[model samples]
Target: MADPVAITAPTTVLIKVIHCIVGIMTAPLPHPTGLAYHRMGHCTGRHRWWRPLLGTLLFLGAYLVLSLVLFALSYGVGAAAGLRELPDGGHDFGPLANTALDLTSIAIALPLILLAVWWPGRRPPGTLSSVDGRLRWRWLARCLLAAVLPVAVLAVTAALLPDSGSDSGEFGAWVGWRSFLTSLAVLAVLVPVQAAAEEYVFRGWLTQAVGAFVRSPWFAVLPQAPLFAAAHGWGTTWGFLGLLVFGVVAGWLTIRTGGLEAAVALHVLNNLLGFGVAAAVVDGLSSDETAADSPWQLALADVATTLLYAALVLWLARRHQPRRLASPVASSPAPAPAPATTGRTVGHHGESGQDR
Candidate 1:
């Protein structure tokens, strides 16, 4: 017989390897007190200086490659289906098809952001969602309710007030109920995903990416704002300024309330309202005028309304007291030098069931 000791040695090695892999998979996330939304990335134990940087490269590559593929596929399909390319409709697609394509393109970032956190970043992805580890759905629902009324009021008020500077679309003949309802249904489903992805990219990932290096939330929040504005494409001066201000406000709210809930609530509602308006009228969706195309009056009112909405959210936050800072997971205080934080950590497999 082969020597028993030799046989046992190989088996022992296999066991040790299995154990090490398991340990990494289940390793607890750092639990740090006073971990703000921006600083959540720095709270993980696995954080090396290079992880976030590498992850960013991966993110850009993956997103660009996939997005190109998606658009090419969409273009091919649209052509097959007799969809009109602009100036008739979406770029190489029908209006509705192109709008769905755009919304879906933005939506993909949400998953990619989570993946970056899990692999190269080597932490629980939940930390990026909020201080509480996962998205606070209850809090998000409440915020959604809070935003609806003000946004509705403002949208109606703007419509009633005559269009200034001539860019806001004319209230043309109502598209038949079929066109309006179909567009509404599509917007309702995809708009929230699109909005949430943007929030995750700007408010969630960008802020925390910077916060991983800098402790200050303002420093973390400020950088993403301009990028957010630029992403919308420069239009009039007022419109660009409006986007910048909106970005700043959204970023601030993400930090102030300890999660993306408030920002997402605002974004989803705002997009739905805006898109709904475009859908309601003749060929309105065909016009590519975004929030970035707002004239001065609309831009100023948009900013003011955002601030007012922020104020209302702040009042609600005070009353509800959503957890803003990371709390330690271990019985003893988490080590000061730990790399990452939140109610949970990024796992290779799935999220910690505890925090959710």
Candidate 2:
């Protein structure tokens, strides 16, 4: 058996590197904002077109570098394990390994995003999490709770649909008590981080940066949706559409609640349930054959599920009011003028002025 230490050693090193980068990038820059990005123009005090452009480039660079490192580490682990390659020259690490790889890559984005917003834009790290410069844990808990029912319903719906591809056997062969348990453990630990990191990047960092530049909330919401969809490389028309809708709705929730908590909750629930079900029933979350149905029924079911989740979250938001969106630049009181030294003293209540 391959030593677990061998796999973990590289990961530890990568994590240390990530931490060092985050520390340096997040070290207190000026022009802090507690509000969302659309209202952050005054904080940075720079409206140059290049600011957003450069900021985007910086974020991409950080993400790409970190992702490459993670990929190399994962590849090294796979090579050591003697994992076999698919016919297409891709290694099949099964569901557990794949989930770990996906989540680790996603998890790395959180600090990078904080760096992107802080270093170049001169915003505080809290601004990336919420409009109030703080993450509302209570509200996030509520949203996560509200997301459960809708996601469960979607899961049931997907299960009821017939499997249309031969890859059903693929899941069965790869999935067993041992592998399932391992995948479950990985998902339990990393899925939340993965979901939250994505929300912070798309709905939080990228949206706000664009919002800050255009000074419009819609500008923040719309452009990021396609980019989010593209990130998935869903490989089918319906899959692309489904992800696009998800992105749009998530962005909307961010704007509506003045924070990323609601969107994060919805995403966490959706991924947790989706991946959990695949791991349990299909024995794998991905397959060589596109497991989608011919008429796009399953795809539509996924879309419906996402929409239902969105509706439930929105309803909850309305019932228990979250913080309204505010300007990122908080107003500070101006200092009062100093009293003159060699001047006549002013008397109160119509008294005569006395010379000092």
Candidate 3:
């Protein structure tokens, strides 16, 4: 199979094109998610010229930074500990430590990253005017459903299963409060570094660029999902699926809410809770060499459960309004109507008319 990194860019572009085609095909119909925040005012309009380029730059920079940090930490620690005898893939690291680091980092970074995107003074910043007609309880319900449902189902199913063969990996006796807390502290530094970077690119940058340029929410949804998935690399099919679902949910939430705040909040929460839970589970268990067995069944169960969980969350959250504010068709200023007489000229600036 072609390496994911090699194909990620082309694949993401292709997905965007496919989504645009689908959106164009479906333009006449109502958007299915109970709201058309992206369609508010106009379904098609001129997009900012720099959107795609800016988004791509942000994605690349974020990825490089996070990758370097993780690599350095893992390599430096491994070398210092003289754990060359350690197993490949280093599954022996305490799950709690890994997870804690992940949660802390993401939780911290999400807010700051969003501020850069959503702050009032930023260029090309999304504004309240970009929001749908008005807030609706139904849409909120859908957001919650999409966010919570998959996780709940996965948790329940995982709880019910007997220790599967794949569950046997040892977290190593080296993990304790000090180690776990240290990892959490490191993650506290990196998770935000990672998570904020992701949301900024995928949700803030990519979603708007694709939606505006392609002229459809569905089209906007396409590019981000697979790119999000592919970034996980090959061994993590489960993680990839989780990211894809998350991308869809986050995209819809941002569109429906008419802003990125809700999606960012939900994403930060999900990452924090998910990693924390995984760490707790791993920390409580002892190291077992044979724990790593067939994970296919568990993977399937997790996927199914996650889908169910998302559905339930939607059922509980409120919906958003469907009406949209009318906006001008083009980016250029709208031409004024000719006056009845040349000397009876009237100048118009913005919404005001100078008829004095």
Candidate 4:
């Protein structure tokens, strides 16, 4: 039998990085018993009014750098493929190509967001996911399972709805199986990362940092919703409103559950199901088209579905004991007390004597 090799220092660091990544992916759903967002803010150390500003700047700076690198790489690929420029002087990577590239860029940028949280928040990276700074994998898995039904219902409802004249082409453009499968493969690998990245940035890092400054979870959660919606650039009032509602609900879940896991699960499942269905059924996956301007009935249906999902998650969370936030000191076991030592031991006759 070969002797076991010692773990090298580099190997240890790599393992930790992998662990943190996994934690980010598996943040649990919100539960009443979970730590409150306000309390979680306290875990990030002393609150500073300016910390959130700094954190935001750090995130944007890191993301910008990643975006530039991704764009350069994408341009090189288009150039290599001899892709021609559009009449507007922009290169047209086909729909599937564009979707895959966008997802890839998001996946690559996620780690930088984590880095921003770690650097400006001045806390260990895992705290961005939960109050305890560790992901509850089992809890996260449960939330993901809970998310499927609502997301599926929403996707199917959207599919069945009559398309408005606007962006009608988005629904009918079907790439061949080869392209579809390729896009599926990319989405399967990167969508979760992309979704989790958004949750970490808006629901996790921003919420906590802002919560710390304001000392109230509501202030932390509500204020970021518009910013979240703006980030989408949905290009329509209704689309913007929908995204704003989505962000607000996600923020509420984060506060109620005392962590980002529930919100992450909801976001991940929704994107995965939505994108997967689009790739399978739609003509072009890259273009954004939704029934945002549909009749009040359809919009109401969408809102109802979202509410149902949130209710189910909250109900399930009620059934289970909410996980208490683990204290940092408690997470680390105390060193075994050193054996009491004496310079000299009293002999049987009471004479001081050293033990051999």
lDDT of 2 by residue, 1-356 (tens): 99999999999999999997676444332354454445553444544556666777988898899888877776677778899865644466875676677778889988887776667766566767766666889989998888888778777887787764543453654456776787788898899999888888888877877777566678879988998888776566776777777788888888888788888987888778767767775545774323222126666876786688778878887899887554433345543433686464544222447622
Model 2 residue 48 distance off true place after TM-score fit, in angstroms: 4.6
Winner on lDDT between 1 and 3 is 1
Task: Kindly report which residue stretches of model 4 are placed more than 4 angstroms away from their true locations once superposed.
Answer: 1-35, 38-41, 44-48, 86-90, 173-176, 290-298, 324-356
The TM-score values for the models, in the order shown, are: 0.83, 0.76, 0.53, 0.77
Clashes in each model (backbone N, CA, C under 3 Å)? 12, 0, 28, 8
Model 4: which residue pairs collide?
27-261, 28-261, 28-262, 29-262, 31-257, 35-258, 173-283, 174-283
Cα miss at 295, model 2 (Å)? 6.3
Better of 3 and 4 by TM-score: 4
lDDT of 4 at 341: 79
Put the candidates in TM-score order, highest first. 1, 4, 2, 3
lDDT of predicted model 4: 0.69
How many residue-pair clashes does candidate 1 contain? 12
lDDT of 2: 0.72
The order by descending lDDT is 1, 2, 4, 3
**Pairs clashing within candidate 2:** none
Candidate 3 residues 1-356, lDDT tens each?
A: 88998889898899999986554433331222332444332233323456445545664566467655765676578567764434544323455454444444434433433333332212222322235322344554454456565555566665677765454443334445665565456555555445555665566556655655566778876788777666555444555665666677667656644655445545544454444443444353233221112155555664565455444444443443433332233344556766666544445434435553
